[model samples]
Target: MAPEPYTIPITVRGYETDSQGHLNQAVYLQYAEHARWTYLQHGGIRQSDLLDKGIGPVALEVTVRYLRELRAGDETEVDCRFVWGEGKTFRIEQQIRRTDGTVAAEVTGVGGLLDLQARKLVADPREYFRALADDPAVFGL
Candidate 1:
């Protein structure tokens, strides 16, 4: 069975809306990025830890699908799940849902851990994450 996704709540702010009063397209990516970082933090993995280990996370590709529109003051929950497979990369799947249970958007990404010195993707990123995380199970390790 798949593990539960990490989730964080967010409120749409007026400044983040477009002239049409809907959430700006670019902001959705920000929301997704926020969720990903929060997930890492929740697992006790901090940005400094990764950097100290001479590595950093890199997003190779991202795809966003807009569904229902979001407006200022709307409360939403963003959930992030990491799917690990064989090799140097992993998949991140996220969903932004309004309080009413409507899905506003879905973001999918391909990411990897890069060796800062080598400037190349790591052979097994999970090893690095497992070494740094307080509870590797949070990432389904």
Candidate 2:
């Protein structure tokens, strides 16, 4: 069976909205990024842990699909799932949904773990992630 996706609740803040009172297009990326970091924390991997190992996560590309407008005070849930593939890169799939289960936006990102010192993508990102996570299975490792 596939592991459950990691999720977190987020409330649209007034400052995040645009002049028209809807969420700003750029804010969608921020929401997706927050979800990804939270997911890593849920798996017991902290940013400090990666820094200690001289490795960090990098996003090579991202695409956002806007479905519904989000206004301030809107309560939403953001979910993140990791799709592992061959080589050094992986796919991150995410969705932002309203309280009533309406999908407001979807985000897809191509990412990789980088070797900070070498300034290059790592050969085996899964191995690095597995070593850092308290429960590797939670991240589909």
Residue lDDT tens for model 1, 65-123: 99999999999999999999989999999999998889999999999999999999999
Listed in order, each prediction's TM-score against the native is 0.98, 0.98
lDDT tens readout by residue for model 2, 26-128: 9999999999999999999999999999999999999999999999999999999999998999999999999899999999999999999999999989999
In model 1, pairs of residues that clash are: none
Clashes of each: 0, 0
Weakest lDDT window of 10 consecutive positions for candidate 1 = 1-10
* Number of colliding residue pairs in model 1: 0
In model 1, which regions exceed 4 Å deviation?
none
Error of 2 at 13 (Å): 0.7
